[model samples]
Target: MKGYFQKKKMIEEIDKRIIRELQGDIPLEKSPFAVIAGRIGISEEELLKRAKSYLDKGYMRKFGAILLHREAGFKANGMGVWDVPAGDVQRVGEIMASFSEVSHCYERPSFADWPYNLFTMIHSESEDGCHEIAERISRATGIKRYKLLFSTKEFKKTSMEYF
Candidate 1:
């Protein structure tokens, strides 16, 4: 599917390099952009302008930190899948997204064995906390049929690096 921007050609080589560099850890300093600009052989003003332009043009979403949920005391990362009625998928998704506990929520195609169309990622301190959140979601959305799949093991968890 095409992205919101759908303007890949608008991104120049320098922008691609800047994006690649951003994929790594941004400096923890008063002037992080200056540090990045220095490394990329560009003026800080130009870097700031380009970054702002990216956001303005929908080339970039939001720039923010990716917290380590486990380290942050969120021990359980539950995938809550709901068998929401076909006509109410969008409404259910919006309701799910309104919950602070739900970091990600969207609609997905259902399979023969699996009947869930709406899914949410719930992070909490324990399995019980996850279940409580799920229950609350059920009460809010009026979707009784749901499943909470807690992660047994997280092989790898990191933000996608786009170069």
Candidate 2:
């Protein structure tokens, strides 16, 4: 908290302007940052530089979409953990990514007791749909050792507000 506050304090007036402008949707035109820069009376290069600086200083985690799964009819969300062998981890991960239901997949470190290493997030309209996708991934990867963890409650999701 102290570090974040200190960093927040370091932001200059121009950085605040950039942050405020970026809080809304960037333009969809060819040069979106250029348009933003023009609106803020700064060059495109400076806008890009300041944006990169903001990210490096941990002010922004990422610039990406925040999917509303519930609103999109994907009410069920499950994180499927697979205990894949070290040599087969990448291959299994690729196979898991082929499924549209698998929104996000990655290889994570495993603990001594918890050997699950490959984690894949499955989102669907129903729990059964998620389970079906997990089963399909397991069968396709030939790795039967896996578990699907379903969410018991839903929480609202939102992006950061740095105005």
Candidate 3:
């Protein structure tokens, strides 16, 4: 029983290390996984297997790239807030999220003063483009009561580290 607990602890530690390694920027190289595996003192195949296991076991929800929009020439971003009905939020959010211009879409709690419940992050090359994207989303969702809040400045943007 003591031996089993010790093995489990070691496994948990390795998983934590993997998560820590993954939380940072991935190497931009031909064999990025190989590089990461080498840092973790594991073979590339073993790293992939463990990563797959993490996904299969629901330990990790998703592994996806975070595009730096500014570097990619998407300079303007707008927070499109919609006053969507409670019953229609899910359907409308799906429609809004379908647009390539939209990067993030979710429903948030509405305040008495601020009734906009659904929000989407639309990105484009210019502020006008963002507004146009918001207009398209409004047309698709048929939710006319909306506003685009453009960012004046970005202080920081980074992914969360759970490890």
Top candidate when judged by lDDT against the true structure: 1
Candidate 3, residue 69: the lDDT equals: 84
The reply for model 2, stretches above 4 Å from the true place, is: 1-20, 26-39, 43-65, 160-163
lDDT tens digits, residues 1-163, model 1?
Answer: 8664344456578988888877788899999999999999999999889888877876777777878777889899899999988898888899999999999998999998999998899989999999999999999989999999988987876778886
Clashes of 2: 0
**RMSD, one per candidate, in order:** 1.6, 5.9, 5.3
C-alpha positional error of residue 102 in candidate 1 after TM-score superposition, expressed in Å: 0.2
lDDT for every model?
Answer: 0.88, 0.88, 0.87
lDDT score, residue 11, model 2?
Answer: 59
Model 3 lDDT tens row, 1-163: 3543256665577777888898787899999989999999989998899889878866677887878888999999999899999999889989988998888999999999999999899999999999888888888889999999999998998788876
TM-score of 1: 0.92
Tens-digit lDDT track of model 2 for 23-82? 779888999999999999999999999899878877777877766778889899999999
Enumerate clash totals for all models, in the order shown: 0, 0, 0
Off by over 4 Å in 3: 1-11, 28-30, 56-65
| Alpha-carbon TM-score of each model against the true structure | 0.92, 0.65, 0.83
Alpha-carbon runs more than 4 Å astray in model 1: 4-8
